[model samples]
Structures are given as C-alpha cells and as structure tokens.
Target chain A: MKPSISCKFNRFDLLLSLFVVLAAAALALFFLSHAGGEAGEVSIRDGDNAPYSLTLDAPRRVQLADGHITLVIERGGVYVEYADCPTQDCVRTGKITRTGESIVCLPNRVVVTLEGAGEFDAVTG
Target chain B: MKRTLAALFLTLLLCSCGAPREPESVQFFAMDTLMTITCTEEDLDAVHHAMREIARLDALLSRTREESAVSALNRGETVEDAELAALLTRAAKLCKATGGAFDVTVAPVVSAWGFTADEYRVPTQEEITALLTHVGAGGIGSDGEVTTLAEGVSVDLGGIGKGYASDCAARVFKEENVSGALAALGGNIYAHGTKSDGSPWRVAVRDPFDGSAYVGALSLTDAFAVTSGGYERYFESGGKTYHHIIDPATGYPAESGLASVTVVCGEGLLADALSTALYVMGEAKAIEFYRTFEEPFDMILVTQDGRVVLTEGAAALWDTSVAEHSYQYETINKL
Candidate 1:
C-alpha cells in the first residue's frame, strides 16, 4: 500500500518546522554574542575651579550647582544627585541601569562612568 | 533522528571553535600615566620592575630635581649621571620645538611666583620680569656630560618630565614583548596596543572651565595622549585669574581662548610637551603648529566657549555620541 499525498506533505512540513527552530536558536545566540561586548564605564573629572564629584546612582535624582555636584541614589543601579548650575544637565541625566553606563553634565563639567564597581589593582599613590 | 543529532553536534562544535579568547591584563604607573599590562602572571615581575624604573626617572626629572640633579647644575656643579644626561638632552630638543615657549629653564620664574610650593599669592610685575630676565632655554648649556649654567639661572623640567618617563616606560613594554597595555599618569596616557577585546583605549579630555566635566574622548592604540590646562594650579585675586603655564616672554600666565589642550602622539615626551605648548600658544597657534609638523599626532583643543576642535584623525577616533553635549565641532584651522 502506497502513502497518500497528504501524508507525504505532512512529513515535509515537520522537517521544515525543525529547520525553522534551529535557525531561530542560532540567531538568538548571535545577538547574545554581540551584546556581550558592552563593557565597563569610565569617570572623567574636570580638574578646574573646585573639584566636584559626579557619582553614578543606579536610579534616582541628579543635582547640579555652583562648582558642586551630588548624586542622590534612589534605587540600586546608578543615577545623578547634585549640581548647582543653570542648565541642570546633571539632574537631567536620569538613571544608569546597565553594568557599564554613565551620566554626564557639561555645564558643571561632571562625568560619572560605571566600570564594574570593584577597583582593579590600578592604585595611585 | 541520527542525522539530526549529527547536525546539532557539528553546530555546537563550530560555535565553540569560533569563541573569542580572553585577553591579558597589564598594570603599572608613571608620569602620572598609570599603565596596566595585560600579559601572563609570568610577566608581572618584569612589569613591576619597569614601573619602578619609571618612577625613579620621574623623581629625577621633576621640580623635585631642584634638590636632585638640576640643583647641582644650578650651583655651578658638574654631575655626570645617566639620568641627568638623558633628561638634559631631551630638554634641549623640547625648548627648540616650542620656540622657547616650553622652556625648562623657567623654574626661577615659577619660584618667584611662589607656585613651587602651596604659596599661591600673585606676584607683582616687577618680581616676575626680574626673574624672567634670568630664565630662558639658553641659560643652561651642556658639553658632553659637563653641564654649566649662567649665574642666577635655574632649570625646571617638571613640565616635560612625566612625558619623558612615559616614553621610557613604553620602551620597557616593547622590550618585554608586551602585546598590549595602557599607561596613564593623571591626564597623560600612553598605550602599546588595544584592550584585550581589540578595541582602542579611549581617553577622556577634561573640560578646562569645570574640572568635573569631560570635553571629549580620544581613542588611541599604540600611542600617547597628554593634556595641560590652566586650572592645574592657580589663584584668583582682585577679579583676575592667575594660572600656572606662564608665557616665557611676559613672565605672566598665558591667556588664550583654549581651556585645555590634549595631544596624541607616538611618544609620551612629545605628548607632554605639545600639550603644554598648545596650552601656552592657545588654539590658533596650536593648530598652526600641529599642522606645520609632519608628525603623526592628533590634537583636541577645547575653547573657553565650550567649543572643541579636533585634528582630522582625532575626530575619526572619537565616540561621537557623547561629544554632542557641551561641545560643537570647530575647525579653527580655517579661521
């Protein structure tokens, strides 16, 4: 007894379905590989006037003011706190969620970058 | 089912084979340029030794040298040492390059202004000109290991010392066969290769107006980047600003549109000197000076207006996304 055309078509459909699943898996993996390249953050200090610190708060408020800046930590990742300038750029630099993220204020000249919280042996004496 | 299993195994095998290997980590400090060498732990001792050597060079070439070798030369004494000989030779070249703008012999003026210590009081014009009369590159001369100085003259190589140290440390990296590393002394930076991930090291240029902000980023591989700014040391009095980098001619702090100058070049010595020269020359002359030379250096000049000017090469290496804030691209070369 010979198989019907419908039965043959069903077998082909199953093979096609398997191929689609395998390709999807590979695509997902490629995305992950690219995503892994996202790296550590860097903090830049402007060495002029009064030295102000711009710290990364995972999530919270940012304040900018006259040669002074503070980062109010709202949540756990990163955010800007204090600044006393007209632009309030530091305050506008919302939250830093990722591992290597930054918040920068130009008017006050503060930059806060996150690079894996742990200090890697680069000590200055 | 067997065929499908074979295909799956092959895919896994290919993925594993194509995975990227981890990169090495190298570390050290000199010329305010902290170096991190990424290599095997087997190379750690060599790296440490090289770093200490660099620090020693720093002590020798620094303003502290007033107590070290430069003082001996200043007091009509002759001293022939490997460190002093090398430093004096480099000083001569830098002095010529800046057309006397980057003189190592300006220490007498530096001291007269009371900037050598924490004393930040502004000096009177008479006091500055009196000292300037004795400070110039031609004040000191070397005759094959024998250094002689004119009366009432002193030399200060602090402006160019860290850069020289950085260059020497880079040589150590090369001699030790380091594949990749970065040295950053405060704002001075040198690199032998990219990070383990094969991306160029990105250095931030600080804004001169506000110390807490960055002007922009400079991406470099196997190069050096050094910055000099007015705010490094200064005191404000009587509604006037006084900075550290003084004009060799006027015996007063240099005033220009540039807030800071960052030079990227092959050696730390050049980066160090050029950064200072540009600081003194300001934006216009700095751009002209950079263009006149055929060297492979790129410069980032930040003006007091928060404007940024980059050499064509530097612009290509920078991360444009962050540069948009508090910075507008300015090509001062045409102006």
Candidate 2:
C-alpha cells in the first residue's frame, strides 16, 4: 500500500498544485523577459552650470547654499527634500521614476534628470 | 533518480559562470576632460595608481601649467623630462610624415585664434600669418634626454597627450595583473586585453552631430581607438564656425570638409595622432595617405557631405547590423 502522505493528495488536488506552480513559472518568465532596466544615473545641473552625473544606487543628500536646498536619493529615485526657493517647485516635483524623466526647479536653477541604465562599456561622446 | 539528474544539471550550470561580474569602473576629471577607467573590483588600487600617473603626465604636458615641461621649455629652459623628450621625438616624426599637418608647435596659432584661452574670436589674417611663423614641428628640439622649444613656439600636446597617458595607465594596469582593463581618456580608448569574460570588448563610434547616440560598434581586444572631431569644440564668430583643430598650413580651422575621423591602432599615441591627421587630410588625401601609410590601422571618416567612409578592411571589425543607416557606408579601396 502507498503511504497515507501520497493518499492525502488526490488527482484534482495534484492538478491544482501543478496549476499554481505553472502560473508562478509563467509570471517569473514574463518578468525576466520584460522587466525594464534599473535607474542607472541621476544628472544634476544648477543654473548655467555644467551637468553633474551621479550614481543612483548609492543613497546620499546633496546640500547646496548651506543646506538651503536638500537633494536626496532613495529607492533608486532622486527628489528634493527641502528647498529655499519661493515656489518650492522642486520639493513638490516629487520622485523621478524613469530614464529621460526630469524635475526642474526654476527659481533655484536646479535640474535633476534621469538617464538610461545601460550596460555599456564606455561612452564615446 | 530524476531529482539526482536535476541536481547534476544545476551543478554544471553553476560551474559555467567563469566571470559572472561586470568589471568595476572609476571616473574622474583630468586633462580638461572626463576620464573613466574600468577593471575588476580587486584591481581598484591599481586604477588609483594609474590615475595618479595620468595626473602626473597631465601636469608635465599641459602647456599653461607654470612648472610643466612644455611651459618650462617655452620659457627657453632646457627641460629634462624623459616622457616629454619621447613625445617630442614622436611628434617630429608625425609632423614629417603628415607634412606638418600634425604639428605640436601650432600652439601659437591655436592661441591666436583664442581657442586655447576659450575667449573665442576671429583673428585677423595678419595675426594668423605672424603666429604661423612659429607653428611648425621644426621649432621643437629633443636630444633624447632634453627638450627645448624655439622662441614664440609652444608645445600643445592636446592631440596626443591623452593617448600617451592612456598607454601609460595601461602599462601600470598590466604590471598590477589587471588584464581586463579599459581606459577612456576623453575621446581616446584603450582596451588592455580581452574582456574579463574572455570575449572581445565592444566599443562604439559616436555620431559627430548626435552626441548621445553611436553610429557603430567595434570589437576590440588589446587595441586603441581615438577620434578627433570639430563638432564638440567650436565657436561662431561673424557667421563663421571656427573650431579648435587648426590647420598648420592655413593658420585656421581645417576646412577639410570632414566632420570627424576615428583611427584604430595597436598604439594609443599613434592612433591619437592619426585621427587628427586624417581629419586634416580630408577625404581625398586621407584615402591617399592610408594606402601609402605603413602603420597598421583602420580608419573611419565622417564627412560634411553626409557620407560615412571606412578603410577597406574595416568590415571585419565592426558590427554591420547596428551601423548607422542615416548615412550611406562607403568603403575606399587601398590605392
């Protein structure tokens, strides 16, 4: 006689378990094939100054004007934590989510934009 | 039995990942351009050492730096830097080969055009003619141990200095057992060896007009690629676009009708010099230059007429499918 452990599971139950496993496998496959690239960079520009590229993986705060404006990076996004600008547009702009997206603070003359997270060896330009 | 077979398959798959991690990278600004050095994470110390070596070379080569070798020689002092002497000797040979098209002594003309100081202006014909008097490789003298410059002539290694520094950094990386390293000093690139995963490294050629996109990719291993273009640095004065690449003959920016030129060679210094030389030579003469040139290199010339020209042998080195389709790809036969 087969063990009671095997008898506890009938054909229908086994089929249901198999269906669940198959669904999870399909979802995993979908994610593997369709997941977008991660946030690779955050480029910042202040006023008429040159743009600065920084790594998005590391979390840090950028203090400018003796902490008048605070730029923070968290969870692969960069957004202003505080700003002394009159309108507070940068602080209200919230987080950046995708490559090519940007948050601009006109009064502070600050710009934070996202760039594609590519696996390039080196950029020629 | 089926589970045992599955476990065996998993073990085989795990053993196949010989180089699972991407090479580590370090970026910094020097030589008035952004430089990036990439290698395995364990070779971080070696990368730092290489960057220091590059900084030393930058100080020694910068013409404006007060105590630099070029500046000292310009001040009529017999400077004693082995690297400077070597560079001068090489520059002399390049100038002779290109018939002064590639001249380090063109610093006077370059400055006269206001490019060196970044205060762009259109110099008068008389001003350029007078500056051209001091703009030839003949004004430089190197005696294998010392370097000197003639009066009014200054050495600007802007063309080849970055390449030399890349080569220097490469040597340091090799000494430190970092075989899979790539150093990009501005528009110059040097691949130290095969990739860490034992595959050829893929490098791209950028479109002169479009900075963000690449025109094509090259499969390089133990090679150097350098490009010189007028698109990146230029100023408009009175409806005229004056670029930084001054033609020693005309005492003006090269009107060779070329947007850019990229040279692939085994030596970084040679590639750097060749890229500028080809751009100055333009299309017709550059084709002639390539046929008779003895050095082994592949050339890619982007023209102002919307043409992309390549040396006859470049087909094997580039990715054909991903090449830019906007411009027709033309190949010149070796004359």
**What C-alpha lDDT values do all the predictions have?**
0.64, 0.77
Global lDDT of model 2: 0.77
* Residue A18 CA displacement from its true place in model 2, Å: 12
Candidate 1 ranges with C-alpha deviation above 4 Å? A1-125, B1-43, B65-67, B294-296, B331-335
Task: Tell me the tens digit of each residue's lDDT in model 2 across B22-109.
Answer: 5676766677666778788888899999999999998988876787878888888998888789889999999999878898888888
In model 1 chain B, the worst 10-residue window by lDDT is B26-35
lDDT of each residue in B1-335, candidate 1, tens digit only: 76567656765665654544443444333433334444445456656766787767765555544566666776777667756766677777777877777887888787766667546677788888788889777777776576777888887777777777777778887888776666655556776776554667666665566543456676678888888887655767799878788878778888878788888788787788778888888877888888786566778887888788888777776655533256788653322
How would you encode candidate 2's per-residue C-alpha lDDT over A38-65 as one tens digit per residue?
7777887765667789898888998754
Q: What's the distance in Å from true for residue B180, model 2?
A: 0.4
Superposed on all Cα atoms, the candidates' RMSDs to the truth, in angstroms, are 8.2, 7.8
- Candidate 2: give the TM-score of chain A: 0.59
Docking class of 1: incorrect
The DockQ values of the predictions, listed in order, are 0.08, 0.14
- Residue A93, candidate 2: alpha-carbon lDDT: 52
